[model samples]
Target chain A: MAKGYLNFVLHAHLPYVRHPESELYMEERWLFEAITETYIPLIKYFQKLVDEQIPFRITMNISAPLITMLTDDILQERSLKYLVERLWLAHKEIRRTKGHNDLNNLAKFYYYRFVEQYKIFKREYNCNLITAFKKFQDMGYLEIIACPATHGFLPLINITPNVSRAQIANGIKVYEEAFGRKPNGMWLSECAYIPELEDALNEFGIKYIFLETHGITNANPTPIYGTLAPIISPKGIVAFGRDLESSEQVWSSITGYPGHPNYREFYKDIGYEADWEYIKPFVAKSGHRVDTGLKYHRITGKTDFKDYYHPDWAKEIAEEQADHFMHSRINQINNSASKMVIPPIITSQYDAELYGHWWFEGPYWIYMLFKKIHYNQDTFELITPSEYLSKYPNIQVSEPAISTWGAHGYSEVWINPGNDYMYRHLHAAAERMVYLARCITKPTEIERKALNQCARELLLAQSSDWPFIVTMNTMVEYAHKRLKDHIGRFNALADMIDKHDINEEYLEDISYKDKIFPNIDYSIYAK
Target chain B: MQLLKSEYYELPAKYNQTVIRLLVQSPTRMFVYWEVSDETIKEFNKNNQNYSDCTAVLRVTNLTKNYSYNIPVSPFANNYYIDVEDSGCNYQVELGRISKKKFVNIYTSNIATVPSDHPASYDLSKDGVLFGNYLCIGNKKRLKIYGNKEQYSRFQNQNHTAFENRRNGSSENNFLGSSDNFIGSSGNSMCF
Candidate 1:
């Protein structure tokens, strides 16, 4: 019998970045890269675990925007097209590195990997990745959760009760529409929580939410079990705080498993190393160099000069690190379980893309980690938050402190001086939207479509990605443009509604452009 | 085909409403931004011709502690970060002016509550089910950093100082975006 439980939660998300107007937008590649590197690899491994009849339980929250993009006809075709291009690039690499044994083996590895991904994407899943995930959920191997409609930072945008309500309700609506059932858990936007969020969670039937470490430690009256067990809020919503020790073991990029010298270097891609003309077709259409997902070097100890990657050595290290991670958890679980009446649950949560997208060997690390947990030890077993709640329904009740997983564990990352200008526009738009939702009773078909699109624009404009990107200083221009564009569209639609003269052509144009929530009812704001 | 002529990149400078908004930036700092419409400014100037001598100030009242302080801000500035001394307190702010000697209130903000940064003093369990000892490795040192008054204040303010350091080219950690330090993948090193 297991003495403790380990809940692994992965929040997979990306801002909606579809552009039908032109392919020159380099930002669209964000989706393609993530699909090939993160989502497909995850699906591949999950499918393998099921085939081997390995007992494992994992929870994942695929955000609403990502679900919309995954199911869209345009982006689906683009994902397949993107994989085909990578396949061709791998073919070229195989020919280019025929003589060098180390480079040739790595090239062949990529070639087969892309081929398998293409087959799984095109034939096995029929270009719809959500179906693959849904199959896993139905098989009892995975628990899929919901996220905010646009990945908005809830605390910053919670100016009025209705604003956060609309974001959460629409998020649930999207999850239900995609999965054919209500989600039992929700990955709070950035794991940010305020006390008022409980009403919305209970209304939407969300049973649990994960928080940062301090959210549990600093709770009112102090949680008796600390972050070792889930705390129940007054409203009956279960809140699980992340365990710092386990988080540091896997998430610390400097000391974590991803930084091992044998792992493939995420930075040393062939897009910039290749002859400009040779790699031009694989990169952005504007002729700018970008990551082509063909990195060949290893992260060889903080130096500019990197050595050719050895996949065999990387696999051995992933297994070794898996052993290290498992043993560390076994000890942590045993030390705490002896002192408690009930088995303590250590919640380890991370961004799903970090595995394969950022750390090329991350997905395999997860695969090996699960296998070790199954075969190597009985000290702790993998469990989802929902499963744990089912087994142990009674929990300590406490109100979590306001918190987020960002720097210094608060809203400074989203509301700092660098991006404080957007909140005014966002709040004004939400106020106008609530008023419109209340005032507009009966409407024509065109007016109804326009109202729904207006809601979509407001949600998109409020995404935390823009502020986060601006603060990160990586894609400032694109982030600024996206924020401005969404706000601009929202105002234009509001004016059309106010004038009582809707532009059919203009409405059709933006309806196609920012069409995220197809089933979005404007009355969600009224609730 | 180009859809809807290039999007207007600039937002309206003002929404034509005189309003003040307060947001909690951290446990120790609260951000307040307000806009006084031109019409409201004209109305204020009409009432007091000594508008030039008036300084725009935010009168922050800690509703929980029953104390108030004033932060003088430039009339032209749109926002200011107000520092709070205590966490877990309810604060209400008013955007007004100090003309000559009297305080004239323009608009009052919604009550903003700063979050607590330390563990509570009491546990409700009668049997004294204390779980603090098992919280982390080096539990005493970690609790000292989180529960100690002066140390907790410095730790909370370190995030802002870190940002300032990065802006001044003194630190390598991008704070929120460095993949080497931050757990999140907001870094630009691998972003396309």
Candidate 2:
């Protein structure tokens, strides 16, 4: 008998970065890179498990922003263009590295990877990855959850009245529009949580949510079984806490599988490493260098002089690590179950992009991990939260502490001195949005359009991505610009609404530009 | 109309409203950002005879415990990060001027609730064991407990080498900076 269960939750999210005004903004590549490296690779592996008839149940949260981008015709077309360009670069690398055996082989590997993923993107899935995820959910192998519209950090945004409610309502709306049914679970933005958030989750019929380890361990009345058992909040929503050991094993770059020497180093991309003029065409439209996703070297230790990547070695290590992971879980469950009355459940949640984007061999690690668990061990079964709840419906009632999966496990990462200036603007805009929604009981078509756009702008501004990027110090310029753009557009819309002079032209342009949540009702903020 | 230029997106300096907003950052810390409109500042100085002797201060009151402290701040800074001693306490801050140790109210903020830093010492745990065919949740509703017993038979263990020894290499070389902690290392996508 399986002693315990392992719930692997992968949260896939990217801030909506679509610019119809510019052909290829450097920032747009964030989505394109995620699609190419993370989403497609994950889809291919999921398809593999299905074809082989491996009985696996995995939980995935595809954020509303990612879904909107994936389904948009422009992004789909742009993704194809991005893929074809990488293919072109890979093709060129094949000829360029002809004399060298290791570089040549790695180049060919990337060429085939791009080729296969391209076909899967174009032919199999028809350019919409959401459909692929939906099909998996229908097959009962995956449980896809919803996220806040635009991936706003709920804890801080909740300060503005009804903002969190609107975020939740619109998040579910986007989920239903994409997945054909309401979501059973929600991956809280950044796994951030507060007790009051349960009211919103319960209202939205979200049966369960995932929180950080301390959020559970530090709950009121104190969780008896610690993070091993899912606790039901006072409001009846179940909460799953991340298992620290499992998280550290996979997420710690210093000790995790991604930091292994054999894997392809994420940093050493060919775009910057190659001769400038030769790789310029594959770079950004602004002629600035960007990651072309064609890396030729392995991590090869902490040194700058990297060894040529060996895929065979990385694959062998991934399988070995999978075996190690399975055994570790078996040992952990064996040790924990002996002490506890109920079987312990270890929940491991990670950002889905880490798999293939940041950690080059991550998706393969997951693939191998699942395969090993299926054929090799019986200590723990892979279970989703809903499935676990179905088996063990009655849960301990406790209120979770306020928490997030950020540095120091709090709001410091999102609301520090670096990005604190934006909150006043966000709060003011949200208050105005609520006011507008309440006062404008009846409105013309353009007025309604402007109001709905107002809500969208506020939601986009509340995204945790902007402040996070500002604090992280990578791509600070783009983050500043996005926050400024959203807040600015929102104020302009509010001004036009107040003056009773709805500038149809301005509204039309922004409506098309920040066109997310097409069916958003401005009335969500009215309450 | 052409698209709004990037410069148009610059956020305004302040809304013309006398308001104080307090946000809970963590158990031990709270953030206070307020905008006192020019008129409100003028009105305060005009009304007060000892305006020159007044000091701008953030008077943070812990509503749950009934205690308060004054944090001296620069009025021109417009915002301050206030550290609190208590977790799981309701706190409110008033941004005002203090003259001769007397606080003159300007704008009181909405109550900010700092979540509990530690679990409640009061144990409310009940037996987690499945006692019957159905389990009741706090007299709310009864749910049938299926008790997942479907288990795979024990299989032969495969002999696989542990990969930890292979991780002897230092992570000094990289584009994305390396971190010793898991949350610190999560990539640009904000995994944590």
- Kindly list the per-residue Cα lDDT of model 2 for residues B1-192, writing each as its tens digit: 246433356789768998899987888988888887778878878777455468888889999999988888875778888888888899999888986567899899998888877776652322121111112332332222211111000000211111011112333222122221112112321110
Q: Which 10 successive residues of model 1 chain B have the least lDDT summed?
A: B137-146
lDDT of 2 by residue, A1-527 (tens): 77899999999999999998886589889999999999999999999998988988899999888999999988999999999999998999899989988888988999999999999999998999999999999999999999988889888878877898889889999999999998989999998998768667767878789999998998764676789988765456678999998888889968987888998888888788789989998989988888999888899998989998899999999999888888888988988887654578999999999999998888888999999899988889999987887776545545677889999888999999999888888889999999999999998888999999999999999999999999999999989999999999999999999999988878888888898999999998888
Q: For each candidate, report its DockQ versus the true two-chain complex.
A: 0.18, 0.18
Q: Considering chain A alone, what is the TM-score of candidate 1?
A: 0.99
Per-model TM against the reference: 0.90, 0.90
The Cα error of candidate 1 at residue B104, in Å, is 0.5
lDDT of 1 by residue, A413-495 (tens): 89888999999999989988888888886877877888888899999999999999999999899999998899988899899
